[model samples]
Target: MGPASVRPAVLVDFGSTFTKVRVVDLRDGSLLASGQAATTTDTALEDGYAAARRSLDPPWDTARPELVKATSSAGGGLRMIAIGLTPSLTVEAARRAALGAGARLIATYSYELTTADVAEICALEPGIVLLAGGADGGNRTAVVHNAGLLAGSAYTGTVILAGNRNAADEAAALLAAAGKGCAVTANVMPRVGELVVAGCRDAIRREFVRRITASHLFRDAAFPVRMPTPMAVLKGLAVVSDGIAGVEPGLGTVLAVDIGGATTDVHSVGAATRRAGVVYTGLEEPHGKRTVEGDLGLRSNATGIVARVAEDPGLATRCGIDDLDRLTAASRQLAAHRSTVPATADQYTVDAQLATAATALAVGRHVGHLTVQHGVTGPVRIQEGKDMRESAGLIGTGGVFRHAADPESILKGGVADERWPSSLRPVSPKFYVDREYCLFAAGLLADDHPHAAFALASRGLEAL
Candidate 1:
C-alpha cells in the first residue's frame, strides 16, 4: 500500500466471454505480462481471475501489487430504463446519456409513466432508471408525474432525477419517501434542441458502480471499479482523439468497431460536419458517441445478422456465402457452442464474412446520412446519426479481429460497402488493432495517469 508498490499494478477486465489480466509498469506505461481465462459466468468470476493470475506464473505469480483495478461487461453489462418528457427531446437525450455511460438501454418511456409501464419496468428489473424531462426552466409536469409513478411502483432500484431543475428536488424527495434510492443530476435536456449528457453520464456510471459493488459477484474484487468495459474503452478512445504528452498527439477523428459474441458496438470521437448541401434536422449528435447493435454479432446474434444480410441483395454473394442454409446452420452451431473456434478453412471464411457483415452493419447504423425531400417551404435535407467521413483512424477489436490472419481486410471491406447511406466513411485512415486487449485497462488508468494510459495504449496496438 505504498507509493513504490503502486509502480506495478494489475488491471483486469471481466468480459462476458473472457477474463483478461495485465500487469504493467505504471511508471513508464510498459506491459510486463498478460493472461486470459474463460469467464466463469455461472459462478463467481474470481475463479477465472485466479486462473488467469496463475497463468501469469513465475515472477508475476509471486509478485505483490499495490493496486487491483477492474472493469467488467459481465451479466449483460448495466441494464437501464429511461423515462423522459418526449421521445424526440428529453427521452432521446436520456437514452444518449445512458448509452454514453455504457448502459444497455432496455426500455424508454415518454410523457407520464403509466401503471402498465411501471409493471413492465418491474418485470424488466433494470439496475437503474434514468428519469429526465423538460428543459431547465421548461415544463415540469411530465417529469414530476413520472417520478411519482416510479416511486409508487414495485421497482426499488436507483432512480436518477435528471430533468427540469425546478422539479428535481421534489422528484428526489418523493422517491426517497417511497423507500426508493434516488440520485439527482443536471437535466439531460437543459434547453430545447440542446443535449447535455456529461452530468447524467457521470451519475449513471457512479450508480452502476454502486449497483455492481453491492452485488455478491464483485464482493471479493478491488475497490473503485473504474467503469464498465465498454465505457472504459470509450474513455480511452477519447484520449486517443484528444492526445496526451509523451504519447499520441491526437488522431483527430477516430472510429472503433468492437465485435462481440452477443453484440457489435461502434464508438466515435470527433466533430460531425455536413457535406456539401446536406442539412441536419435532428438533434445535435454528441462528439463522443457509442452505439450498440444487439442483433449484429458472430455467435448469439449470428442468425439475425444473416437474416439482415439476406434482406440485402448481393451482400451474401459479396461475402462469398452462397448457401444461406449452410450459413444459418453454422451460425446456430456457433451459438450453441460459443467457445468453439473455427477448425476448418470454410469455417474461418464464414467467420471472417460474418465479422465483415457485422462491422459494416454496425457502422452503417452508427453514422448519419442525408435524404432529400420536398418541404412546404422548399426542398430540404434530413440527416441522422454521426458523420465520420473525416475520421483519421479506424480501429478493430475483439475476438474476430484478434484471431484473423488479415483483420484489416475485414474492416476495409466493411467500410467500402456501397450500401452505406452516408457520404462520410473511414475511406482512408490509419488502421490499428487492440491486439493486447488493453483498451479497457488504459481507460481505467486514464482517471489517475492520463499520460501513462495513452502511452500504454499506444504501445499496445499494432498497425494492421
Candidate 2:
C-alpha cells in the first residue's frame, strides 16, 4: 500500500483546561494537523472533543481517522491516597508507585490507621486507595489491620492491596465482606530495600481506565480514555529514553518538565550514574521517575509559588521581582482569575516570574542532592535521589512554555549552578520544545505503533 492510502489515527488529550487533538499518519508517524478547544468538563466532554475535531484543517477535519484514542486529566486526574506501615520503606514505595502510575497522590499515611485518619480519607474521597505495607514475607499484621479499618470506613474508593503477599488473601476477604472494591497485586516492596512496583503500577492504570470508562463525564465521547495524561506523557518519555532495540536509538538520560495550572510534573528516564566518591543512599531510584509538585503552579497555586519565592530573596530578585507585596497581590489576582491571560506588561512579567520560580522549586525537589559529611579521614559525599546532571536533553511542555516568547529562559531556571553544588539538575543539555504537543499522542501510539510513536516524537519537537 502507498503512503497516501494509509489511514491516520486521531489522538486526544482531555486536559484540565483544554481538549487537544492531533492527527497522525500511521504510515510514517507524521503529524497531519492539530487543534484545541476549551474543555467542557463541567458539561459534556464530547462538546469540546467535537469542537477540537472540527477545528482541524482541510479534509483532515472532515475525514474520519482509522482509529481514535484518548487520555484525560480533566477532572483533576486520578486522585489517590497511599497508606503504608513505615514512612521510610513501604510508604515511600507506595508513593513512588502512585506517582509513577500518573496518580495525583492526595495524601500518604504511615502506621496503623486511626479514627481521624479514616475520617480524613473519607473526606478526601480519592478514586483509589493504595494500601501497601510490609515486605512479601515480612510483618503482615499492619497491612491486615489497615485492611480491616478501611473495610469498616466510609471511603468508597477501590482498595489496591500491594502489601504483604501472605496477607493478601485475608485483606481481600475482609474488604470483600464489607462490599468494598478491592484489587490484589504484587507487593510494592517484595523484600527490604527491594522495590517491585510494576504490578502495582499496572493495577493502578487498570483502575484508572475502568473509572474513566465508567464515569459519565466521558461516556458520550467517541473514543475511550485509555490512561491519564501524565501516564501518556511518561510512556512517550520511556520510548524516547529507551528506544526499541535496533529500531530506534534512545536518548540517554533525558529530563522533561510539564508546568500546569495546579502542579508541575517532572519526568526523568535513565539510569542513575553516580559520580566517583559519592555514596548513594535511600531507596533506589526507578529508571523512569516522575515527581509532581502539587504546591508549585502558575495559576491555582500562584500564591504558594509567591510564598516560596518570598522565603528566598535572591531567587525573587533573579525572577525580576522587587516588591514582595506587589507580587503577592499579582499572585492573588492570577489565582482568582484562572483563565485570564496576561494583558499588561506587568502581568506578563509576574506570570513569567511565577513560572520560573515554580520550575526551579519543582525541579529542585525532584532531582537528587549531594550532602557532605565530615569524617575522620575526609569529607564523604552522600547522594540521594536520581542523578540527572548528565542528561542529554531537556524538554519543556505545558501552557507556560508553549506561549512564552523566550521559553529557554524559563527552562533555565531548573538548571544547577555553583550557588548550591548539591542539586543534580540538568546542566548543558540541549533544550527542546514540544511545539506540537505530540508527546501524549506518541505515548498513546507507543504500545501499538512504537516506531511511529518514536518518529512522531522526534519530528514534533523543536530545538531551542
Candidate 3:
C-alpha cells in the first residue's frame, strides 16, 4: 500500500494505575505516537481512554484510526482463587493455568475445602474460582467435595471445573442445583506428571471477556477491549520468540519481565534446552510460560520487596541495598502513595534496588534449577522447569525499566552468575527495553496481521 493510503491502528492498555494508548502504522508496524493517563476504572474507563487519546500527537489526536483494540488490567485485573487436590501436582497446575490466563491468583487451597477455607474464599470474593484436582479418571472425591463446598458458600462468582472427568457431571450438577455459574473444561493435570492447561486457560479467557463486556466501562461498541493486559503481552512475546512461518525470523528463546505496582510477571518463550547428563522431572514446561510473583511489585507491594531483600543478605548485596531501614521507609512511603515517582536521589536508588531485587526474585522463581540426586551409579543431575540460559534476548518492561538511566543494570539482576550455578537464567542476553510500550499493540494485531505484528515487535523493542 502507498504511504498516503496506509492506515493506522490504535491500541490501548487500561492498567491499574495508567491507561496507555499507542498509535501504529498498519503498513510497516512502526509506532506513530503514544500517550498515558491515569486509569479511571472506579469512575469510567472511557474517561481515561479519552484523555489518553486527547494527549496523542498531531493527526493521531484528531484523526480516527482504522481500528481500536484494547487490553486491560483495571479494577485489580481478573482476581481468581485456585482449588486443587494436591499442592505439588494439581494445585501447581491450577496456578499455572490461572497465571497463563492473565488472572491474578489471590489464593490457592489444596485438598478438601474446610469451613475456614470456604469462608476465606467467600471473603476474598475473587471473580473466578479455578477448581482443579486429580488426573482424569483418578481420584474424584476431593474435587466433588470442593464443588459442593463452593456451591454452598456465599461466593457468587463463576467456578471453573478442571478436574477428574469422571466427576465432571456430578460437580456440574451440584453447582447447577445451587444456581452457580460453572465452566467445565479438561483437567489441568489429565495424567500424572502431565500438565494440560490450554483448556482451562481458554475458559478463564472467556470468563474474562464476558466480565469485560458486561461492565459499563467497556459497553461502547466503538471500543473493543479483548484480552487482559498480561495475556496480550504474553501473546506478543510469543510472536517475537516464534516468528511467523516463512515470514519473519524468530528471536529464538526470549524472556520478558514486567514489573508492576502489585506484581512482577516473568514470561519466557522457547523450549528448555536439552543438556547432556541432565534428567528432566516434574511436568514438562510449556513453550510459552508465565509466572507472576505477587509479592514482587515496585509500588503497592514495595514493602514486600523490601522485606524479601532484607531477608536475603546475598540478594540485598547484589541489589546494592546497604541500608535496610532506609529502603523499608521508602517502600512504605511509596506503598502509601502509589502514584509517587522517584524524585530525590535516595528515592531513585530505592526504586532501582527494589526493581533489581524484584527482577532477581521473580526470575529465579520462574526459571528452572538443577539439583543432584544420588543414584545407583553415582550422583545424577535433575532439572525441573525451563532452562532459559540460552535465551537470545531479555526485555524489561514497566515504568522502572523504561525510565531508568541504566536499565541494563536492573535487567542483569535476573541473569545467572557463578554464585548460583544451578539457576537456569540467561547468562549473556542482549537486553532491550519496551520504551514505547507496544507489546500489547503487537499482540492485538498478531492474529489478523502476523507480518505487521512481527514488524512492530522488531521495531518497538529498543535494544540497550
Candidate 4:
C-alpha cells in the first residue's frame, strides 16, 4: 500500500433522513474522517452533500481529495413496476430482480395488461418498468403483447426488457418505434425453474446511475453515482461472504437485516441446500438473495406494524404492547421525528420493540416457508424462499440497530422469535452491527479495492 494520504476518496450515502460521508485512504482503506448531516429534500441533495463534506474534521484540513463516490435513496429511492406472463413463474422472477436492483416495487401485474393497469401505471409513475415474461425458448406471446401495451401507453420511463431471448428484439423495437427508452437484458427466467438475474440487476444499476446523474443532485458532479444504497449494501455483503485478495477467511453463509424508516430489507448469501424430504418449487434460489418488506419499517410504516400487532393477540402479548391508541401515538411521534433520540429507558424500549417486530416480519418474509402439497403424482413438501439455516453470520444495519442503547439484545430477540415461520431462520449465526454505516462505502469500493473494502467494512462492524 502507498502512503496513508496518497490517494484518499470520499464516500457518501444520501439517505432520506441523513447524509453520511466517509473519507477513506484508498491506499490502505483506513477511514480518515466521517461526518453526517440532515438530508435536505426541499432543494438539491447537493446542499446536504456539501454540508456532510464540510463536516468532516480530519484530513479535510490537510488533504483535499477530488474523487467523490456516492449512493442515494434520498427521494424515496427507486420505484419500479413489474409486468410478466405468469404470476408464479416469470412474474416472481421479475419481482426478485427488481428488489435485488434496489427498487421499491410499487405494483406488479401478470398475464395480459388491462386499461385499468395502464391508468395505475400512469398514476404510480415509477422510475423504471421491469418487463419480464416467458422462458427463453418456451413462449413469446405474452412478452410481445405486453411490449405493445407499454409502447402505446403514456409511460415514458426506462423499460428493462428481460424476458424470452427470442422476443427481446421485437420488444425493444416496439418500444423504440414509440420513442420510448428501454434496455434489453438477458432473460430473467431462461428456463422453467431457472432464474438468470445478474443481467437485469446490472442493467438497473446502470439506469440508477444514469437517472441520478441526470437529476439536479449530481448532474454537475465530477463522477456519476455508483449504485443505490441498498444495492451497494448487498454487494458489500457478498464481499463479506467471499474472502478478499484470498487472504481473509470467508464467512461461509451470511444474512443481513436492515431496518429503515420506510422499509426493512433482508439479504442472505448462502449455498442452496435441499432438505431430505422437501421439494423446491419454481426458480432455484440465487446464491445472493434480497427481499424488501415495505410494510415493515420502524418509522414510516410503524402504523402498519401497530395494526398488525393489534390484530394478533399472541404477538401483542409477546411484545408487551397494549392500548392501541398509545401505540399509535408513539408510532406517529417517531414517524414525525425520524432522528429522535430516545429520552428515557421506556422510550428506548418502545423503539427497540418496533425494531424487533420489523426485523422478525421482514426476515420471515425473506426466508422460505414450507408447505405440504398433494399433487396428482404424490405428496411433496414445497419450499417458498431461500433457506438460511446454515448462515454463518447475521448482520444488523440501520439507525435502530446502530444507535440503540442495547442493540445486541434487540437483535438477539428479533432473530430468535418463534412466532415467525421456522422453515428459514438463522441457526446460531454470529451477529454483527454496522456501527459506522460503512457497508455501502465498502460495497462501492468492493469492485476496485476488494481488500481495502473488506478492511473498511470489518472495521465499522462490531461482532457480537
Q: Give the runs in model 1 whose Cα sits over 4 Å from its true position.
A: 1-6, 57-63, 245-248, 274-277, 374-379, 421-423
Which 10 residues in a row give candidate 3 its minimum summed lDDT? 56-65
Tens-digit per-residue lDDT, 1-464, candidate 1: 22354477799888887888888778877777788888877777788888888787333742567567888888788999999888988898998899889998888999988899999999999999999999988898887888888889999789998999999988888898999999999998888989999999999888888877668666553455768888999988887787875645877898889998889999998888766677766689998999889898888888888888889857777665678888888888888887778878888888988888787778877887767789898888777767787688889988788888888877875464566554456667788888887878888888788877887887877787
If the candidates were sorted by their TM-score against the true structure, best first, what order would they fall in?
2, 3, 1, 4
Of the two candidates 1 and 2, the one with more favorable lDDT, higher being better, is 2
Query: Hey, what RMSD does candidate 3 come out at?
Result: 2.0
Q: Which ten residues in a row have the lowest lDDT in candidate 2?
A: 56-65
The per-residue C-alpha lDDT of model 4 at residue 408 equals 67
Steric collisions counted per model: 0, 0, 0, 1
lDDT of each: 0.83, 0.88, 0.89, 0.82
Question: If scored against the real structure, what TM-score would every candidate get?
Answer: 0.94, 0.96, 0.95, 0.93
As for TM-score, the candidate ahead, 2 or 4, is 2
Model 2 scores a TM of 0.96
Candidate 3 per-residue lDDT, tens place, 275-320, comes to 9999998778888899999898888999999888877788888877
Candidate 4 structure quality by residue, lDDT tens digits, 1-464: 22543678789899988999988877777887888888887887878888887788663642357467888998889899999899998899999899888888889999988878877897899989999998988789888888888899999799999999999999899999999999999999998878889999999999988887787665465554788998999888888887664589768788888988778898887687788988777678888888888787787788877777777767666665665577779998877876677789778778888877676667767777777889998988888777777778888988888878777665664454567654577768888998888889998899888888888888888997
